[model samples]
Target: MNQLKLTVSILATAGLLFFIAACAQMGTLPSLPASHPEALAIGQQVNCAECHEDQQKGTLKPYKAFNHSPVFVKSHRFYAASDDRLCSTCHKSSFCNDCHTNKVQIKPSTKFGNRPDREMQHRGNFMTMHKIEGKLDPASCYRCHGRANNERCIQCHR
Candidate 1:
């Protein structure tokens, strides 16, 4: 009977350690900044830079500053607008995208030694086409668009 009790206590201790490790991996719990009350009243109109003065340049400023806020982190789980739409609610998309696009360059490059011979190159565009013939799954779109109460199919299709 004593051996069974010892085994149960060991299992319980292991379970507690597992829970703490999982939470740590998920990330730190958000904290409410002292300025939260003043910032909250302004609604979405508050300029992030007004409080995050040091973040005049990179994506880290908005990400770290807002993630620390109780409001931003809580709402982030329900919607995918925290970075751009949240700020763009007051700022323009062009202002944000100009810096963002440059930061996230999407240029495709040919792999070295993998290029086709010049004489064998086709006259038209040489872009490689990948044909995925299968019944497309709609569930993938739900990762972002599925959560919002107002999201429409046209938002992505159009």
Candidate 2:
């Protein structure tokens, strides 16, 4: 009985040591300091609650604190314009190519599929109206199509 108890104690201690060793071998994850200096300098984080509502909230929240907001997609341009370096911290340069590919990508109508929502990009007979829209605001066209050489645009405009 005494030997059995001693064996159990040894096994428990060994198991605990192995667990600690394994945890140590797995390097810690990147963490935001209570106020990450760059984030504070950039004025993204004023307080802990900006990200961490609960103790584990910040740990689970994806990307940098402000990057996951619903408006981040629309608002990211302003932030990127101010400091692209901040954007680069999480978003790779390739991330831009997801939307802004240089090649002749599939049309959104085809890409979004042939569903009811997958009609023309604009409302009310866009194929007829797009000429007017393009002629009026070429800048808008240049967003997806490179200003220098857009074969798709040249095909129609020229």
Instruction: Give the winner by TM-score.
Output: 2
Whole-model lDDT per candidate: 0.42, 0.57
Model 1: CA > 4 A from native: 1-13, 20-30, 39-44, 54-158
Q: How much lDDT does candidate 2 score?
A: 0.57
For candidate 1, what is the TM-score? 0.22
In terms of lDDT, which candidate is strongest?
2
Model 2 lDDT tens row, 78-154: 66665566456545776565445577465544554544332234544667888789899987667755654767666
Task: Provide TM-scores for the models.
Answer: 0.22, 0.41
Collision pairs in model 1: none
